[model samples]
Target: MAITSANQLELLQTAEAVAREKMIDPGLVIEAMEESLARAAKSRYGAEMDIRVSIDRKTGRATFSRVRTVVEDEELENYQSELTVAQAKQYLDNPSIGDTIVDEVPPVELGRIAAQSAKQVILQKVREAERERQYEEFKDRAGTIINGQVKREEYGNIIVDIGRGEAVLRRNEKIGRESYRPNDRIRVYIKDVRREPRGPQIFLSRTAPEFMAELFKMEVPEIYDGIIEIKAVARDPGSRAKIAVISYDSSIDPVGACVGMRGSRVQAVVNELQGEKIDIIPWNEDQPTFLVNALQPAEVSKVVLDEEAERIEVVVPDDQLSLAIGRRGQNVRLASQLTGLDIDIMTEAQESERRQKEFAERTTLFMEALDLDEFFAQLLVSEGFSNLEEVAYVELDELLVIDGVDEDTANELQARARDFIEAVNKQALDKARELGVEDSLVEFDGLTPQMILALAEDGVKTLEDFATCADWELAGGWTTVDGQRVKDDGVLEKFDMGLEEAQNLVMTARVQLGWVDPSELEADVEDEAPETSEEEEA
Candidate 1:
């Protein structure tokens, strides 16, 4: 074993310490040294020459050997040459056809170059190993809050030194109202971890939604314990945020607990977020009610849902509209994101006018379809009977009992009621057939072709048969049809009917024509037409 110099010995120990501290395999460092030595050997010698080197870890001693190729002649100058059989036999008992001679080189000749090469290899390998170590150490911590020292500020970005590594806090990630100074200890949520050529890159954020969530976890015990669940959160960090909270236990007031006594709990989070206002609302299962609550500090008079449009129109007092909409519409914007609804805030007067227009349209439709008198039509409207089903399904005697309804008028109303039902039912059947809703029509037996034709004429031509046939829906409400009338004599009847058994004959004809199954009739109950007075008939 050869003794190493004190300076060389210190270098070896320092390399070992770095390897140990970084958890790098000492063997990997030696392997890197061997590879580097091989490269240096090639650089020193021509391509035809081969060199092998080995390092002893205990003594830091290295040995070098040179190998030469055997050739027929000494044609190459300044080169190790081949040996003839006679000359090779002098050195060995037997020499083969293809063989190489090994020569040991003096350590002094290669020592200076080998030491320099080995040092470079060890330094490069240590950097790579340290980078890999740092990447693995921080990759697991992505999306967690880490305490870091503000290292420096560059172009509005704050660079944070997170102990093991440094992270970039982009301008967008900083709370606008908060200022960070060098050496300031702060907690930032890790937004992402990325691997770069230099080392692991950590991206941190203070404005992220999770930043607020983490603050809540630290400040509120209920949140940490999972008793209060944050259903959704929306924010304009450093300004305001809206969070929806729900409690598993009925006894817990989620918002109250989150708010804390004297606003201690939420205020801690607010302070951390640079005094951002948080509106913690109780989550409700009913969407309209929930939306109304989400738009807090503003009273809502009503919430009208337009499901087809995927929007909600909230009616508030004129004075509260701006409050409901918030500054630059932030309140309603966050509310919409939290509730997954498009919110439109409307003043009370605007909503009232819209309601009046809708009511007027419904009233006009009901009167035209039922052929009812203006007085009765208005009466129906006032009673919330805006459509035909409410009018047609109302018991005839019950309607007669209402004010201004006499026996004769009641009888006439009943006849008209039967005609209206038949017409509406026929339209439904036609619509069902047109919509390929034969199976659904089978559910309601006694539907005839004439009835179906009547319905088709009334613009009902699909199995989704009804006044409103939309996406498998059967809108069975009264809608107006032309050429329908109530006779003045109080006998509800259709003109130009020569057939005596027309009433019973209509079903028989439908059955014979195979338009409807006989089984359908059995399943269907027959609707009797009101009897006509002989005096009125004359």
Candidate 2:
């Protein structure tokens, strides 16, 4: 092989060019080449022997050397890593234990098989560098907008050539009516940047709520400048969208700023969206006010919010029911998304009928369960005693507010309520134990007796199972569609818990099980365990 220093110069130049085009450090490419040469050197010399290679960055000279560590006769294992001091003296005048002796070796010629292996190494390293470069470049830019041209399509997915890289816009992430041809320029939201086995896979989306939010940010100076905050966004792509905005500076009207003079600002966004109707509503702290604003163009008569359930019941004028509901429930569904609450719409007539039905049911419950006279039951129903649980749990002072009920009568009702609840809980606990729930898990604090039974029913029979659960896995969280936080269909909702209660319950279990490090905790659960154990024993 007629290899020369001049030939090595060409190798350096090629590596530099590849590194520049791939946007990676040139030193990394050279290191990979060194590794490739070292492997080739090993094939010629003893495959099991220690070999190392280095390339001169300036001169591009590749050199191979065999390495041996000097050790005592008893410590010597093999030539790959160790050599006895007596054997090492042949190469060096004197050798001490732990010292290294490296001898120069002739460079290996890149034969057919060796050349192919080296090429694979270089390509693999380059691909890895490229993926890392792409990940670093786009990870910070996630949730931002980029403009790209459609390069091609495969399996209903579009490949767009963004400025520095190619990205994929998945089929579900495309707007329903939107179509693109090759070279068609389109804006997309940087949905995610993931490092896959093959390379970095960038996901793009035009139908994402953030995509619309980003467009508004670009079109409206107020949003870009931080004078106006786009609080929340919801979209039915290619059809309609709703955005909630709030002003940090009260002088600037968020809606007006977004609207722009003569509708030019919002009109730009709408045009980009291909005539998707845009609703710009002012955000409010009060959830009811926010829901009212979100369900715009529909006149609402009353809003009944069940905060624990994260649900809203909207009663509209009988004439406005169709409008509130919209065509095929579209308006209400959008409102639910925008407000992050489940909404049940009712016309005034329907609401009145529902109220009458509920009243009759509650009156019957009080009469049958509480052993109250019909007059007293109707009175209790009028006072909003929906169930025995509420009557049992409400403060004595609240029960005293009921007409014809004095302090003594309130006390008597509360006593009966407690007796009924204790009886029901005893039955549930007996059933849970029969189902083989672990005593330690059943005795764990922060979980109600009912929650314990539910856990057992779900086959979470051990503290380990309960401790391993994520708060969301136990409680549930807002669902995401293409990286947008949509709504909560949480598993914890099936249990009687509100999300907050579930969070506490899961955290308590984790702390008690010692799954977390002691330094990570603000206080010790160990201190509290004695009290709990005593209570359980009693």
Candidate 3:
């Protein structure tokens, strides 16, 4: 066979260039070409014909070697079929008994086959190499944004031409409110990158939460400079987004800074997101306040957070219910995500009805516990004696003032109220001990030995001890303790110590410890003067 033409040299150089560009080994391309040529040759010639194809990297010239089996009869009939041992010796140094003759096939016959096989091999190799490159390029950018041009649409999915490769933006990934056209430039987050036998698959998204965050970074200077940090973000993409933002500096208003003057900064972000509304909520350590902020534009009357249930019951005016919940529950939904709470929205009317029902249930429990009838309970309720505390504290004259209550009934009611109050106080003291309320005693008119013992274990040895503890400390500590550590002054602060209660406790403790006289302690307590005067008269 003669030397190949210039076209053959160009082909080999092109293959080498492609291999380098795709970061594939040149030897691999040559090997693939050889395999393809072997398959092609076997189909073209007889299977008995031994064939080998080699490519010269420097010149791009291809050569094919043909060897035939040395047979006794040479029954196989083909161009390069069989050869005798003596006939093979002409091309071999020392021909063995079964040695086949080796000869170079003419370039003309093998050129067409080699060229076709090389073309298919190079195309396949280039594709596989490109896939590997794409996988490597996108793996690091899994959670980041990428800008690309819309390439084409197939089966409701948009193919994006990212600089290095193509990415598929599935229908679900598209922001529901917007449309895109071919050649349209858009920014999308690289949701995931996966490898497949066909090629590397790049999944793109426009509705991801990070997309809103990235848009903010692009539009808001404060966010870019780290003056304001977006603590968390939640979005009902194409509709609204709630971003919990906090500012490092006190002077910087995180919500206003994110919103910018006249809504310019957020408007830019909104425009980028195709007019998606954004709620820049000031992130608060207080879950209730944060939730209130998260459900913005709707004034919240109260937010009752149930930490144990991870749920929040939000109370708003009846008129603000729709606004708080937003269209199709977008506001509450975003609030739930931002605050990590299952938010339940309630109107003022609904809340009022609920409170009424709760009050009725509580009243029923109170009456049943005291073995009282509804008439007596209603009479007590009319006197503003809803519970044992009110019943114990209210005067007999106050009870008689209520409708349907005579002086005799008032006296009986007072006695009953006193008894009910003492019993409940004893129960509460026991519960406080079980809850590990330290140095906390609850003193009513009368208490039992069991109640005193429980109070002592709770760290409340006497009325002096009870008066020394803050109300909040008592409430908070009792709520959290599971018969574990006892509450102390240090623990009171952790339980949100109230200043007024703490002051009162200090005064009481000073009097009880004899650091200050009872007269001094009662100096500011108006109600105690009458009690002291009565005790002196007795």
Highest-scoring model, lDDT: 2
Candidate 1 lDDT, 258-317, residue by residue in tens = 999999999998887878999999999999989988999899999988664356889999
Tens digit per residue, CA lDDT, model 2, 1-538: 3135758998799899999998899988988888887877788787888889988888988888888889888776785768888888898887888889888888877788887888799889888877887888888899999999999889899999987788999999888857799999998899998888773289999889999999999999889999999999989888888999999997999999999999999999999888999989999999998999988899989999988767799999998989888887778878888998989898889989988999988888787777788899999888877778888889888998988899999988877777777887888788888888888887887776777787777777778878776666667666779845566554455665666777677767777777766465555645555465766778
Candidate 2 local lDDT, residue 200: 29
Query: In model 1, which runs have C-alpha deviations exceeding 4 angstroms?
Result: 1-11, 20-35, 45-57, 61-124, 198-200, 306-310, 358-538
Order candidates by TM-score, high to low: 2, 3, 1
Task: State each model's CA lDDT, in order.
Answer: 0.70, 0.84, 0.73
lDDT-wise, the better of 1 and 2 is 2
Instruction: Give the best candidate by TM-score.
Output: 2
User: Which consecutive 10 residues in model 3 have the weakest lDDT in total?
Assistant: 483-492
| Candidate no. 3 TM-score | 0.58
Tell me the tens digit of each residue's lDDT in model 3 across 426-456: 7866666666554423433323434445546
Candidates in order, TM-scores: namely 0.58, 0.77, 0.58
Better of 2 and 3 by lDDT: 2
